[model samples]
Target: MKWTDINDIAIELADSQPDTDPLKVNFVDLRDWVMALPGFDDDPKHCGEKILEAIQQAWIDEVA
Candidate 1:
């Protein structure tokens, strides 16, 4: 998944970190976790604040 794949990445994150709270995650750590995802295949430099925020929001929704 790339930077724009927000929903997919969020789902992966929700499943990977079920005990973690997405809203408490900082952008730096969030980016790292996203990169560490099994199917993630995007360039680190391609991700930005907006993308990370969207991913976090989606993860919040996923876990809700």
Candidate 2:
């Protein structure tokens, strides 16, 4: 599914779903997911940040 909002990702992760598969990306709970990966292997913190940043960037680009 195509997600255009960071909130959705955070919401999914809250359910303990999978986030490894970019296609099945669910959540990015920083507190519970960070330090769970090699370089953020399954690190929710890093993942959350990445997704949030992407969303923010997209929004910026849309207006720019």
Candidate 3:
């Protein structure tokens, strides 16, 4: 998955971290978790605030 695959990444995160709250996650931890996802294949430098926000929102939606 690439940086654009926010929903997919969110689903993975939700499943992997069911006890954690996405809304409370910081960008540093979020970036690291996303990068650690099994199929993730994006450049770390490609991530930005907007992408992180989108990912966080998607994760919130997934858990909701």
* Best-performing candidate as measured by TM-score: 3
What do the candidate models score in CA lDDT, each in turn? Answer: 0.92, 0.39, 0.96
Q: 1-63 in candidate 1: lDDT tens per residue?
A: 898999999999999998999989999999999999998998888988888889999999999
Top of the candidates by lDDT: 3
Question: Which has the better TM-score: candidate 1, or candidate 3?
Answer: 3
User: Which lDDT tens digits does candidate 3 get at residues 1-64?
Assistant: 9999998999999999999999899999999999999999999999999999999999999999
Give the better candidate number (1 or 2) by lDDT. Answer: 1
TM-score (C-alpha) between model 3 and the true structure: 0.97
* Residue 52 local lDDT, model 2: 56
Model 2 is weakest, by summed lDDT over 10 consecutive residues, at 36-45
Pairs clashing within candidate 3: none
TM-score per candidate:
0.95, 0.29, 0.97
Error of 2 at 52 (Å): 0.2
Total backbone collisions for each predicted model: 0, 5, 0
